[model samples]
Target chain A: MTGFELPVALFLLANLAASLWRVLRGPGDANRLLAALLFGSTGVGILALLAFSQTPAATPLLDVALTLALLAAITAIAFAQRAWQRGTDPKRADD
Target chain B: MTSALAFDLLLAALLLLSAWQAMRTPHLGRALLAFVVFGLLMALAWARLDAPDIALAEAAVGAGLSGVLLFDAWRAIRNKPDSGKNAGDEA
Candidate 1:
């Protein structure tokens, strides 16, 4: 199981790198924000895999992963409530 | 061990890329999103360095709080009626 951890973590990192393209080419603000959401979820998985990969299993990293998950949710809520609108242009704010 | 090194190198590269994108991107909203991505990647770097405490702090304060604060600033700038005209003079 430990042998597979690093590879899986690397795969997730690749997932993150791919998401950056979406962020770069976003024709809409919502598309860019979706990439950020992808970062949050993938980051959690990377953290969890790293936590278990160590020989002694640094369990505190699990707590960090949990915190990241909660914060990701909060960040999404804040984005939806405060920054995003239904039909705003990427270059200009309607309000 | 080589794979571990590879993971760290990739994380470091991504971290630098995100940080650069956050600063160099012309669009304020996309730049802010890049900043959030940088923070998240920074947290992972900290974890890889065997510093869980810093990882936790980076996750909470860097990715979470900073993202919201930057968004608020983006909104304020966007809402300003004469922001574009005064862009050069305001700073």
Candidate 2:
């Protein structure tokens, strides 16, 4: 079991790197925000994998991941709304 | 020993990616986004190191909550004019 654990962990670790690359190299503003959302999802995956590798009980990490997802969604929406507000402001354009 | 070595390699790669991105990015919004991503990735690395509680805190508070805050800051920064004091502060 311990032997199998390391391999799974490594696989997830690699995925995190890929996601980080997306966040860094995303084409523009919207793409970067989208990539960041993907990054949060991967964080959830990493937590689930960690629980499997280290503990019999996965409830704690499951709870944490769920909370993070909810909060992240709300935050993203709020920022989107604010971003919309900026383009409409006339004074913000010249300076 | 092999497992530990693998862990070390993974950690090293994460550090390299994040450091390079942090150093080179000119945009505050992108840099802050990268920092949050780095924190989330590091939290998982901590879990791999056998630290569950730390991982929970890092994911929920360090990475997730902080990501929200920075995204909001980015909204404010990018939405403003050049003369706007809130624009373009580095992450």
Candidate 3:
């Protein structure tokens, strides 16, 4: 990897670190969930960078990134399903 | 070069800070968020260390799946009858 790659990676890492503030100081669960989404996106970025910095054999890493993106969305959906279940349905309660 | 080393050190320090936040946060929602953020940072660190496979896994399993689980739990709690005023207000 070139010297440039490391600095760029580090810069991304720093931003990830800054995002932790939302997680720690969350007044609500949604904030934490948002942080999780950020993690998925940033992780993909880091992985892509690492793969690119490596030999041409880094193709497998791209697959891994794709898997991550898919799973992240699924997870969000699953959580929403569970959270909005029958007993907990806010709309019902409001009615 | 020396600059690379500096970058690594800075990243490591930030990771540590985020990790601490994830573990120590008082509110459940906030704590979950912190942990997710921590996972993302960990993924970035892995990439920096030249392990793209690990970065991807961490991003998906650690951050994504775990985040969903946490949010599900939060929602369950938020909807509980015992949640009462807070739940009503928050909702």
Candidate 4:
């Protein structure tokens, strides 16, 4: 809508792509979870960017962001816990 | 016009670089550290983008809460025997 919003949109998209790459290329569940967390947080940031450009004065976006942030943590914990419970394979697949 | 865009772009690049490095690092311990840095820098980026309130929330949750969660997860997993073999394997 204004000069600032365009680049914000592009940055969010670029980071999202980057996070997706990590999600796919990750060697382990921890790596994938890391990417997933970053990916989700960036999405929340896009929402914040929307709030900033469109509302400009509202404070509710912070609430939304806080909620997303907590959820990301919960997801990370769940994934990492699964990784732990499943027992890591110290051996390569070829072996 | 171009300067602001350039600066913002730099911040975004910083965010991506730190995040990717964190995920790519072989040592899970180091990766957790990188995540903390990413959290802090991203919070600053929020301020650069003219969102102080978001910056505050980001710094608190992103940096503080996420950092703690990462370390807790790291502690939960690192002492286990298999992280050594888990580094580069596709899972």
lDDT of 3 by residue, B10-70 (tens): 7677778767766774444445555666666676567667677787788777767887777
Sort all candidates by DockQ, best to worst: 1, 3, 2, 4
Reference-based lDDT, residue B12, model 1: 87
Give residue B15's error in model 4 in angstroms.
Answer: 1.1
What would the per-residue lDDT of candidate 1 be over residues B8-83, giving only the tens digit for each residue? 8888898888888888866666677778888888999999999999999999999999898877776666567777
TM-score, one value per model: 0.88, 0.72, 0.67, 0.43
- Chain B TM-score of candidate 3 stands at 0.81
True contacts kept of each: 0.69, 0.48, 0.67, 0.00
Model 2 agreement with the true structure over B16-69: per-residue lDDT tens digits? 788677667776666676676667666766666667678778777767677667
Residue A94 lDDT (model 1)? 30
Put down candidate 1 lDDT per residue, A58-93, tens digits, no spaces: 999999999999988888777767677543463533
**Which candidate, 1 or 4, would have the higher DockQ against the true structure?**
1
lDDT of 1 at A93: 37
TM-score of 3: 0.67
Pick the TM-score winner: 1
* Model 3 Cα lDDT, one tens digit per residue, A1-95: 55465567667766766766544553444544465467567767766665676546476677777877777667656655654344433343433
Restricting to chain A, the TM-score for each candidate equals 0.84, 0.64, 0.72, 0.68
lDDT of model 3 at position B89: 34
The number of clashing residue pairs in model 4 is 0
After TM-score superposition, the amount by which residue B47's alpha carbon in candidate 4 deviates from its true location, in angstroms, is 0.9
Residues B1-91 of candidate 4 have per-residue lDDT tens digits of: 5645664676677678778878887656446645765775676567556676777677667766666666566555555677745543233
Write down the C-alpha DockQ for each prediction: 0.58, 0.40, 0.41, 0.05
lDDT of 4: 0.60
Residues A45-76 of candidate 2: C-alpha lDDT, one tens digit per residue: 65675566554655566766676676657556
